[model samples]
Target: MHTNTSTLAASAVDRLRQEIFDGQLPPGTRLAEAAEAKRLGVSRVPVREAFAALERDGLLEFTETGRTVVKQLTPQDFEELFAMRLLLEPAAARSAFPLSRKQQQLLSDNISATRKANSLNEVTRLDLDFHQLIVEASGNTRLLKLWRSLRTELELWLGYLHQQHRDRELDTRVDTAGSHEGILDCFQNRSAAACEKLTREHILSWREWLPMAELET
Candidate 1:
């Protein structure tokens, strides 16, 4: 019974997190456990547990009225989170030299997968996987740990940017794989400076001009 409850809680967390990230449950939206429990056909226990987990991810917070709500993001929040990524990722790429054969294969797979990805979410996921491979290859335990800790927050921002990109009817035909080819080329050449510069540019290419209302909610 205990194991079943835990599984339910984990499922609840995934569903709620995806809803929030996909913009179905906007910021400032109320999170009522009873309502969620009824809607999801689960007990209140799992819903409550899910809330606690999302709260820790900076996605939910309590209002002064003591009600749980999706926490709003700001433009500064996006800038800060992305700026941190710029700083750490390049440094990791610089240090993650002499990639093992397996790591190289992983990166090669990500590159191939990116070209075939159909949706923004799929592209963003593969993009993260590519960057993570580079970071883990660095062999710096502390850097890898910090990067792992940022995964959830990173997913939210990446998903939001990709969604906005599609909403504007931007050129979806642009080759996402083309951007990373240079980085891969640099990696193959063992040029650390080239790899770091290419990686930074690749990340900045995805930067979006977020609307204030969207950021605030």
Candidate 2:
């Protein structure tokens, strides 16, 4: 019974987190426990528990008025998230080279899904997952765990980026997809150096478009 209750609380938390990340519950929106509990058909206890968990994950800020609001990712948050990815992803790509058949297939599938994604949020999720799959395929449990810990903040940053940008030209999407394909091809061909170089270039490309000062401020 206790375990089931805990699982329910976790489910509630994940659902709430997704809503916030997908912009259904925007930053600065208040989360009233009673309202959420009623909406989710869960008791207040679980709602409160979920709120506390989200707070710890840096997704929510609790106030003196006993209200919780979704937190916004500051510029430092974006910088740190990208910085960590820069450190981890290139290494993962290099490790992924000499790829096993399974890893190659996974990368191919991720690229296909990214192309097929109907919405911007879907594409963003696929992009994040593609990097994660590479890291996990490297067979480094510690790296995978650390990356998961960073995902909440990363998702928040991606959500902010998606919301702030409106232009979605086909050429831009094709360019992004081509970058992933380039790294995948390098991995498939067992070219570790090439894979690492492409991965670094892909990450650094963010600087070409993303506004550094606006995001930081």
Candidate 3:
């Protein structure tokens, strides 16, 4: 019974997360537990558990009024998130330096699939796969764990951002995969400096387009 309850809670979490990410539940929108429980066809227990999980994931927060609202990211949140990525990802790329030939091809293929990903979710999955591969290559257990934590937060935030980025015509050509092939080529050729440089530039470039104005809305 305990296991079943946990499974149900996880399912409720995923459904709520998708609703939030797809903008059905926008930032600052209050979530009532009874309403969500009814909507998700689960008991209040699981709904409450899922709310706790989402709060930890940074997608939801409890208010002073004892209500839960979708989290509203502040400018500081955005700045810290990107700044951390800038420091960690480039360092990971530099240390993931000597990836074996097999790892190289795998990362290369991940980038290729990113180019053809049709939906924002698919794009996000491929993007994470590509970068996580680099982090795994670093073979640093600590960095791998940190990267996973970052990925959870990134997944929550980037899913919405990437969808918006793809919707705009001018940004349409600026695929996340654009700098990937170059990065892989540099890594494979053992040009560690160039790989690190390309990775850093790509990370910086993506942040330049994040929808900062959304924080107000």
Candidate 4:
């Protein structure tokens, strides 16, 4: 029963998270407990718990009126988060090499999953997993925890991007894969400097690609 309740909580949280990410529950939209509880087919307890969890992650805001609403990503927030990713992911890439065959396979699997992803949401999830796998493979628990902390906000940003651009191009996929491939090569060659450079470049490239106006609004 304990395990089932835990699973329900997770499910409720994920459902709410995805709704926010997909713009179905847009930023600043109030989360009404009774309404959401009915919509999600769960008791108010799990919904309230999920709201608290999301608020802690900066994905939701609690109003003085006791309403919870999705939070918008400010431009500063994006800059800070990406800066941190630039700092950490490259180091992770440098440490990623000498990977067991299993690690290499995992990377390959994520890449494959990205290719097979049919929707923008699916692709976003796979991409997140791909980078997260790299971070996790770094054998640094602290870095992994930091990355997890950023996941909710990152998902919101990525979701906005996907919504703004309905169809993802093949070129975009290839470009992203190339960046990951470069990092993988650096790992394979045991060249930390090169990996770091690639990671920094990848993070910085988002500046050119992201919709600045949308983020600010």
Best model number under TM-score? 3
lDDT of each candidate versus the true structure:
0.78, 0.79, 0.79, 0.76
- Residue 150, model 4: lDDT of 84
TM-scores, each model vs. reference: 0.87, 0.88, 0.90, 0.87
- Give the TM-score ranking, best first: 3, 2, 4, 1
Candidate 3 — which residues are off by over 4 angstroms?
Answer: 169-174, 210-217
Show model 4 residue runs off by greater than 4 Å: 1-8, 167-169, 213-216
Residue 170, model 3: lDDT of: 28
| RMSD of every prediction | 2.5, 2.4, 2.1, 2.3
Query: Per-residue lDDT tens digits of candidate 4, residues 1-217?
Result: 7676667778988898878887798777888888988998988887888888889878899888887888865777778878888878877867765577788788877777666666777777777888898888889899889888888788788777777666654655666666666666666765667766777787888776456535447
- Residues 124-177 of candidate 3: C-alpha lDDT, one tens digit per residue: 777778889998998888988887877766776676665555555224324667
lDDT (10s digit) by residue, model 1, range 111-184: 78887787777777787788888998998899888887777777777676666567632243235566666677
The window of 10 residues in a row where model 3 has the poorest summed lDDT is 165-174
